[model samples]
Target: MATGADRTAFGPMVIVAADQHEARPLIDDPWARRLLPASGRLAAALTKYRPIRRALIAPTEKKIPGLWASMLCRKRYVDDALRAALDEGGIEAVVILGAGFDTRACRLPALAKIPVYEVDLPANIDRKRTALTKALGRVPANLTQVPVDFNTENLADALARHGYLPGRTFFVWEAVTQYLTEDGVRRTFDFLATAAAGSRLVFTFVRKDFLDGTRLYGAEAAYTEFVRKRPLWRFGLAPDRVEAFLAEYGWHEREQAGPEEFTARYLRPAGRDLPVSEIERSVLAEFTG
Candidate 1:
């Protein structure tokens, strides 16, 4: 059973799951829809467990499917590219930052072959455990869950305690940075920088201008307004400046693509029919230490 804090921490799962559900059929991968029912269950649980925040999340859920579809179309390519880089480098360990109901550890065969360490708030982990147990009847053998409040825990210390090898790891920070403060994001990267020189990072960012625009869908605007009330959460990156930002922290940009480029590379021809204008508004980046 989750407490109020736990429920609150697991709130984002609803949004992500909702987004995946909407976008799954549009994806070329046959297994995409497999993630939907589980995501829906988790979303419902959070709603029942924490009504107010769930209500706040509802509006976002509406916009999520399309945005998520657009994002995942690109992310699938990025994730595959990152996996290829890891394979080429002989890196086997992976740490997923803010792993919210994400099924990569279970769904991606190549990723599942490696040991995956999923880091998130304690409540979210618990919620994920429950959801996975119910959906799959068992969690993946290679998936390990690490529970920590990023504000209170040192990522390095937590990784050390969890037996993460400093020299052989890949960190995937997906749609998580926007919820964190700039300093928090920097600290996370700094900690990763201390890992082995070859360790890599794959992440996505919403350009600040996307948030500044008012033409987003109704649900998008509602969620944005809600997030505005939370001081810790806001999209805070300009696509042009991300490479410079990473350079300052000892990471080298290995590859980067705007959403449109990503779609062109990974998505099927039909998936490409979706409007690309909004997709180009954000960027995905890969970095190597």
Candidate 2:
């Protein structure tokens, strides 16, 4: 049985899928197309896992709105850019923070040659293992599942135990900072900074203004309502402040992608008009330690 803590930790997978399902159609990037099937599968699994959540978990009757939001949100660009960066850096190992039913390890052939580490709660790891076992016959050899509670376990120590070298690693943390407190986010970044000298981190953060209660209610009322019931609410950070925050710890920003630019490069060609409501309006940042 999953403990209460474990349940809370793993529950976000369902929520993320619910969020993606609600925003996928508007996303015109090839990466979104790759993710849609996995997202849809996970959404269905979540609904089957809990009958009560089925109705709420289902995709909205209209799909275009969701796609519109995804394109505007630019998460797909963040993911793609991170992968490209890792490839360019000749990174041999990849760590995915808070991975939730994400199928990149299995689907991305270029990544098949590299070792992929997925860090999440034990329950989620177990669920992923079971699901992948049934779907793929077995977990891929290049993929390593590391289970840990970020609140209690030291990330550096956990990664060390799992054979992650302090040097020569790339970390991908997407759409998770908003769920962490300011202090928690700082601590995690601090840990990564000290973990390895040449390590790189790819992460995203929502702009603080976007999370203001009044603005959230006015612009993303539905999402605001959905997140309100969760223990972890969105906590946005200012884009300008991000550089200063990292500079203090000897980390340097290498590249950045905003929502609008991301959509233009990855989705606009698909002829989609992204809605403001579904967009994440976040900055995707890459930093080197």
Candidate 3:
């Protein structure tokens, strides 16, 4: 299997469809189209045709069942939360852990004035730099790419080395927890626990039941691929216990949105009838310090 860097490809792939959606898109990031590989760019271009789009998406949806739609909803939710926090002021910095092909730093105008760090595996960071250069002619001046291997490195120390100061900050940990070990996840929280008062964190996680093979949640194919077959995913947090879990790290859940809420907030408004997977959900939390 390829390393974690290889998995970053999926991030751009998921958002490109939403970027090209016919109706009101849940999220808008034209940078997603620019960040893709040649074949992906071709596929993205083909999606401009409705019939071709449906035919291409139908099989993936049948196998993963709402994976694409749910991703779009989560992206929308996180983007809104980040913007709201930024507008509230006092946000000193933005740290995106496991930041893959995410384009927020380059595309979002609000982020242009803030110190933004994108932390990922070294290989992925290199890939991101190349993609950003290719897509935007040059990376934005406000962004910094930090490379760290979570399994062996200390999160706090690495960021500190990169000029990260502990203050009111916003952290994004999207689509990352499940791929990490339980200890890895806890160690990251240990770092978060030390953040200054009022730091915000937004993250996505798979349900423990789904991870353990107890409940497939209509995503049997995905479960088989990422869990049973290759075992790419390593950790899960029980939904009901997420708040208590965050509390252990000095964070309080502000909002935890699942499929039903996503459908109501994003899909329905956009006139999309796609089902959202119940296995994965997003949590927005604030550090109590």
Strongest candidate by TM-score: 3
Candidate 2, residue 261: how far the Cα is off, in Å: 0.9
In order, what is each prediction's RMSD in angstroms?
Answer: 6.3, 6.2, 1.6
Give a tens-digit lDDT track for model 2, residues 95-206: 9886756666875777888889998878778877877777678888999889876655678888789887755667777666766666767777777767455666767665
- Give the residue spans of candidate 1 off by over 4 A: 1-66, 210-224, 230-232, 276-289
Which has the higher TM-score value, candidate number 1 or candidate number 2?
1
Give a tens-digit lDDT track for model 1, residues 1-289: 2212333333333343433433333333332233334555555445434454346444544655345345555456546756676669767688888786666787677876788999988877876787677667877888888887665578888877887776566778776776666777778877866766676777777556555554443446434553554433455577678779888776777666654564576444545344333523333344455
Q: Which ten residues in a row have the lowest lDDT in candidate 3?
A: 1-10
lDDT of 3 by residue, 141-226 (tens): 88988988776689988998989888899999988888888988999999999998988999999899998989887888888888
- Number of the predicted model whose lDDT against the real structure is largest: 3
> Where does model 3 exceed 4 Å of error?
1-5, 11-14
Deviation in Å, model 3, residue 155 alpha carbon: 1.1
TM-scores of the candidates in the order shown = 0.74, 0.73, 0.95
Ranking by TM-score: 3, 1, 2
Higher-scoring candidate on lDDT, 1 or 3: 3
lDDT of 2 at 145: 89
TM-score, candidate 3, is: 0.95
lDDT against the true structure, each candidate: 0.61, 0.59, 0.84
